[model samples]
Target chain A: MITREEINNIALLSKLFVAENEMESFRTDMEQMMQFAQCVADADTANINTDDTASSSPMRQDKIGTSLTVQEALANTDASCDGYFVVKKNG
Target chain B: MGRIEQIHSLLCKKDISCRELTEEYLNAIQRDNPELFAYVTVTAQEALTAADKIDRQIAQGGDIGMLSGVPMSIKDNISTRGIRTTCCSKMLADYTPVYDASVWSKLKNSGAVLLGKANMDEFAMGSTGENSCFGASSNPYNTALVSGGSSGGSAVSVSANLAVYSLGTDTGGSVRQPASFCGVVGLKPTYGAVSRYGLVAFASSLDQIGPMASTVEDVSLVFDSIAGGDVLDSTCNRDYKPDTYKTLKDDIKGRTVGIIRQFADNNSISPEVKSSMNEAVKTFEDLGAKVIMVDIPEILRSVPVYCVISCAEASSNLARFDGIRYGYRAQGDFMSIHQLICKSRSEGFGKEVKRRIMMGTNVLSSDKCSFYYDKARALRQALSNEFSRAFSQCDVIIAPTAPTPAFVKNRVVADPTVLYMEDMCTVCTNLASLPAVSLPCGYSAQGLPIGMQIIGDKFSESLILNMAYKFQQATDFMRTSDWGVKL
Candidate 1:
């Protein structure tokens, strides 16, 4: 079972903040998932070679192509300035 | 003739205008969408505008494509230039794309009218479609049950006749399982067979946008339109051609079908699903096709491998949803950008999405990558190799799409493991990167629909479609009316 501390660490790594109130249920769910994930953890893959490119796709020409204009690119954002996305100030 | 041909004949004879047909679908959607929750956004105005263009072409004695003037739904994950393309998650609830997905562009160029954006599992994560933040899309056959998901709404829309056909993305069994539960036809093309340019990435390696329709012929028609290579999606095969429509009616008299014996013998399979499989095998035998049992022991590991790999990919794919660029942003006092991203993701994502992301992050961590992530990848290759060997002995493989028909919505939503297990029967096809289709085979004792899947080797869409078409012709299960959906 995954402990609350481990759950918090995972949430941190995932860039998700788990509130104190929701941590218990979150930990419980994570524990269940880890239990289910044991199948992969226990599989025998020592001699197997991973073929990541089994479904490899074609490569395209490295040339300029039509893309979203600046206006179109930022159209969905609520905060932008000078063609740049705005975010919270970092410490 | 199928619905597409019927509509084409009507348009050619000037018996009905495109606007009239669009209005009929729009009216049905307006009346039934509330109860069904199948559509997240209806594009009545846009559908009419596109339909009117087709009518003008017909009036000028110009030829239109087979799908011209036919209204269809697109799963919310596929991007549309102006339509709100939410993946039924709070994170992207208000997001719209600046350009259309390649599939959407192909259909648009073919003059197919867009009906609306169908609801789906949040980020296409869950199997029951109940994970949608917008609310679960109920099965049209029985509103009390789920429409198998993450493509549930796409299947439901076609089942209910809310649209002539709909497009959905399948990662694992998203398309076919739901198609089975809803009594419709769902096709998942060979990996990289259809372009994934504008499809919201769930698992880049496994995701393929496919079509759901009432008949195999209609599914083939839509597949022909949206398929083929695209420059934007480099993963798509450059030499791929859309030929399902031309060979859809071809005879499958001597075709060899491999039935995996373990899938049927598994205790998890419901009696109804087993009976349905037995009947489907009999039907195939009666049709003069050779049926043989093939042993594929590694198939049982599919679900676990799928979960590990998909979650790992999803973690990376979904990392772009931080508050700065787009999607839901958390509003509060934040001392740093990191805090803002954390809060935004926690608040914006649903429970299942968060859980998967955490699982993914954990599995891919330095300490666990070799033991878990890399092992899963190796197992994936083994599974693919097993499928290749199996296909060498048989032209196609047949299996139950799901262990059971659509279960009660509340029961499924209450348990995440149950929902995950629902993909047991269908995920292996995706893992092997094979072209597979699910079509209605029979109805359960309780009247829920049962689906049988036909999986073929890579780029064998025409063969799979031909076999499915033959099964459909030999049975009436493909007809929406047989499933209690009114025409």
Candidate 2:
């Protein structure tokens, strides 16, 4: 079960915020959803033989290719200046 | 003839100009879109320009390709340069890509007209089209019912005949389920059969760009056009191009069709879906195919497995949307950059997207990682192993594409878990990275379409398409509405 505090913590980690008005319903939904997720523990997976071997695709040879120009790349936002996206200074 | 071939014949024979065909689709969209809500954006001028070029080629007595002069829609999630690719989310409401997704580029080069960007669930997140920020697309069969999602608009475009065929990204049944609901064919190719170069990332591991159309032959034609290795997408499977379309009419006689053990006695599926599955099995038998029951017990837990894996992948993939670069940004003074990110994300994403991100974050957190995230992966391995063994006994597996047909709008809005539960029958294909196609087997008593998914082992699209072609030839399950251009 998720407490109100745990909801706040998860929200912070998720880079999101939960309003006080929506917190109760949101936490309830998450708790129920997590309960559904808890079904994984019920499966007989302990004896099922499986491995976690990582498979990596072969990386293509490094070569230069045509890419979006700075103007085109930054066209979607007004936060760019001098071919770089400008952001507020971090704390 | 398949819809694409028929349209192609008309163009090649000079019976109709491509410009007139494109205008017919554009006019249909203008008339029906406000109610059907199939398209998020209609690129009329672009479509007509492309059509005119195809017309010019045809006037010069040049032979045209199958997809030449065919009008189609691309799911809004697939990037179309200079056109709005919203993914049906407010977050990227004004976002347009700088380059075309490989699938769109492939179709564009083949002379397919773009009716517009099709609507979908926000970021391909929900099973129902209602999750789209723009609005849910109403089912063409019954306007009160939903077109299943996150490829709802793509399915609607084909079902309502707004476009001949469309491109939909299937990241866990987004393509097949909607196609099933809207009474069209959807192929979710093996994980890398189509390039993911410009398709917006949902669950990167599970996402595949696939073809949706009115018939299996048309689906194969579009798949032939789009499938191939791509330098842009390293993971694209190189062996699919110019293959399936050639063998589409091959015999499925003596092929073993497997039915999952759980689905045999499952109480969750509606009576209509079960009835349709029975009829589908009979049709396969009549076509001289053998039917066998295979046990894939782990698939019973697929919904949760899919939820955990998809949400986890989605959390990481969506982290790119910081207000600084692009997409929706919060307007206000913030004490810190972190505050801006939190505010922007909070306001930008829908409730479902935010919930998933939060749940994913919790699962991947230091303390909870072992319980949720790690456990889910091991279970996934077990699921994959189950599919591998099942395919050893059968050429393809069949399951009801969904537990039921399309739901009425707002039916599951009260409980998000109800929506999650609906992915049960379709997610296993994604989990195992297998190619699967959903074909209309029959319709419910309510007159909505019921589809059966034919799943093949990795890169076995040829067998699946051939089986679908045989089934379509044997059964008369395809239904269309009087919504789009008649011709």
lDDT of 2 at B46: 92
- The best candidate in terms of DockQ: 1
lDDT of each: 0.89, 0.89
TM-score of chain B of 2: 0.98
Worst 10 residues of 2 chain B by lDDT: B236-245
Q: Please, what are the lDDT tens digits per residue for candidate 1 over residues B162-264?
A: 9889999999999999999999999999997899999999999899999999888899999988888888888888889968989998888998999998896
Candidate 1 wrongly placed segments (more than 4 Å): A51-57, B412-415, B481-487
lDDT of 2 by residue, B230-303 (tens): 97898886655657878999998999999997997999999889989999999999999999999998888888
How does model 1 score by TM-score? 0.98
